[model samples]
Each structure stands twice: as C-alpha cells, then as structure tokens.
Target: MEPLPAAVTAILLDIEGTTTPITFVKDILFPYIQDNVEEYLQKHWHEEECQDDVRQLKLQAEKDSGQKGFVPIPSNTEAELQVIKGVAANVLWQMSLDRKTTALKQLQGHMWRSAYASGKVKGEVYDDVVPALKKWKGAGMKLYIFSSGSVEAQKLLFGYSIEGDLLELFHGHFDTTVGSKVESDSYRRIADKIGCSTENILFLTDIIKEAEAAREAGVHVAIAVRPGNAALTDEEKSEYHLITSFDQLPLQSTH
Candidate 1:
C-alpha cells in the first residue's frame, strides 16, 4: 500500500464493486430501473428520445431472438398496450440475465438521469474514495474511470454521489465501447486516449480478469477488495496487490 512509483502517472478505476459498493448497484440502481421503467415509458413514450430508446432496444431484441428465454418487443403496428408490455418485458429479461448491451445501458442511463436529477436516487461511494482522489490529483497524477456501465451512467453516479459531485475528479471515462474489460487492447486504448503509455498507468479493479488484461497491456495493477465482491482465491490474493480502501493506495507523494 505504499505510494505507487512515479512511473505510474495515471490511475484507472472501476465503478461497481470497486469505488462504489456492489449493493448500491444490486439493491438500488438496478431495482430503480426495474421499478420505474414502465412508468418512465408511459410518461415519455411520445417523445423523440424515448422513441430512439425503443428503436435501439428493438434492434437488440431482434438480434437476441434466437437466444433462449429471449423476450421480443412487438412492432409499433401492434396495439399500443401490447408494444409497451413487450418493451417492458424485454427490458426485464435482459436485466435478469445481467446483460450489458449498449442498448440496455442507454435506456438505463437515460432513466437514471431522470431519477438522479429528481432526487429520487443518489449515487454511493466508499468514504475513503474522495480523500484518496484528492491526494492523487494533488500529486499531479491523472485519473479516469473504466467500467462496463455506459459513460453517461458513470457520470450520473459521480455527479450525484452521496459524497457530492465528483465529476471533476476524473479526466475522462471509458465504458465497454472501448472494448471488453477482459481484453488487453482496451487498456491500451484507454492509455492512448489518456495520452499516456500503458506503462504509465495503474488500473484498479475487483476482477482478476481485468487485472490480467491491464497487466498484459503493460499497466500496473492493484485489485480492489471490497465488500460484496467475489472472493479472490488464495493464489490471487498473493499474486495481486489487494486494497480494501483507496486510502491504502497512496500515489507519488506531493511533498
């Protein structure tokens, strides 16, 4: 848990199960989408943005038609009630399978935007996250986020967090649009986007696959060990640096 060497000039973080509690996503955010999606659709169905959301979801559903247990959204020609029901059912089905398709995330992002702005939901973060962010930023290191969630969804969490707006803490955010988290090329792409070499980055994530991917990209890594995250095996515990709090991960000292 010593200060990371000066060679690592940037830190890339994961959101759920890393900087934020897994329960926040599992018990709150996901449920918020489930409980309110139908009402949201009913309220906004006439709007162009909602229509775009529905179009994207229908496209996704078409591709998923052959998948087992897939739920299909009816065409607009169907009865309005039937189409609404089909869209809601499709959303629930994708969510139940924990799918991370961009279509699903786009709708969820838009919905969470409404929920967060209305004060119906607030983002959660560990108490130690902000202080450590400050320490690192003060030390002249860049910060960024890389999560499976969409960039808009990532912003909503930090922008409306319980700790208050933390959007300023990051230089940029990356989602699966860059590439899958388990692929080494995504880390390379992220490093390129941040204008740094992969060797200059340190990635923090709870998943070993992501840690391995980052390492393969020549980025340093520290696996975050947080509550509600899957337990790392004994060998993994010894193989990767494990951190329970951001406080344990000091960067190059400013002084």
Candidate 2:
C-alpha cells in the first residue's frame, strides 16, 4: 500500500468487523443480552433506570405493533412476572431482527455497562489495534468512531476492552444518530461536525457499501480484511485498498 495521503488528517472507523472481530458481537454480546435480559430485568426491575428502559421499549413495541411479529409488552399495571415477560419477549423479538432502535439500544447499553463493570464481559479488540491507535494518536491524527452500536455501547466496549481502556485514543464517537453508514451524506455530516473537509478523513470498514458511501462523500476508504468479516467479492478486492491488520496502514512518518 502507498503512504496515506497527506491530506488525510482524520480517521473514521467502524467497530464490528473492522477494529474488532464480527464474532465478538455475533457470538458474545448479542447472545449475552438474549440470555440475560429476563434475569437482568427481574434483578433491577424496581430501579428507576430499568423502569425507564422498559418504558422506552414499551413505546417502541406499541409503534411496532402493526408490523409483523411484534411482541407486545404488558404495562406495569400487569402482574410483575407478566410485565417482565412481556418486556423480555419484546426485547428478544427486536434483537432477533437486529433492530437498532434507541429504545432497544438504551436497554442493551445499560445491561452491557453492568456486565462490563462486573467483569462478566470484556470488549474484544484486534491485537494490532491498540498499538496502531497509539501510533496514529501520537502522530496527531484526529480519530473518531462511527458504528451502528449506540454511543454508550461503543464506550462500554472500548472502556473495558482486553487491552484496557482505548477510549482515550478517540477524538469522538458517532452512532446511527448521525445517519446510516451507507449514506454518503452521513460521511459528509461527520466531516462537517468534525470541522474538516470530507477529503481529509480516511474511513475504514469491512463493508463495501459503506466504503462506497464514504468515497462518494470524498473521503478515502480502505476495507479491513479481518478474520470472520464477510468475505469480500473479488471485484471489491481489486477495487479498494485492503488490509488484514492495522499495521498495514501506510503512515507517512513515525513522528
């Protein structure tokens, strides 16, 4: 790979399938929520925070009622078990479809915070990611994260990662709140928010559509070819710069 373009002053990263393995979320995090949602609710059901999560989920459920396979959450007035069951089922249904609703993300973020705090879970990062981030940070590259995961969930992952806290390496975080990753305008908006031209940001992700979107916004794009990431088409492999590890990023200088 050639040296990174001198105009690139910032890095925008995707989490799953980029800096972290896709299986971390697919095999661990989501399943953790699925297996523990009921127990988590039963344990913390009386807490105002938990109740609020349920309230938001209930609202989402109501909104989704007209849609197929929507799980109905019972109001708090119902029997405690039934209410919890309803919320649990609703959450599971949303998860089954991999929904990213703020309601569902809010609940999942809280649950992950607890799981991380108690050492029941630790975030997974590629072995090369931390050192590369340090090098990039030291070289004065402004770094940011853009992921489908809620910002709080993103924080939890890096805050308790295997390599210790990696949050300090980032300049900021963006979630779906900005926009979908596949939208070119989302890249432009992120660049605008970060006070840079879109051309100054290099985005790394495992998905071709996201790369194309970022490229459309005039940002440089590289696809991370990591283990467990979706296989890239041969056409895609020939069309974009690809790296199997962060160290493959061609920095202009160590200074």
Please report the candidate that would top lDDT against the real structure: 2
> Which digits, one per residue and each the tens of the lDDT, describe model 1 over residues 114-186?
9999989999999999999988899887899999887888899999989889999899999988999999999
lDDT of 2 by residue, 1-255 (tens): 679898888999999999898999989999999999999999999999999998898888878999897789887688999999889999999989988898998898899999999999999999999999999988889899999888988999999999998899999999988999999999999999999999899999999999999999999999999877888888999999999999999776524
Note the Cα lDDT for every prediction shown: 0.91, 0.92
Deviation in Å, model 1, residue 222 alpha carbon: 0.8
Runs with alpha carbons beyond 4 Å of true place in candidate 2 = none
Q: What lDDT score goes with residue 70 in model 1?
A: 88
> In model 1, which runs have C-alpha deviations exceeding 4 angstroms?
none
**Which residue pairs show backbone clashes in model 1?**
none
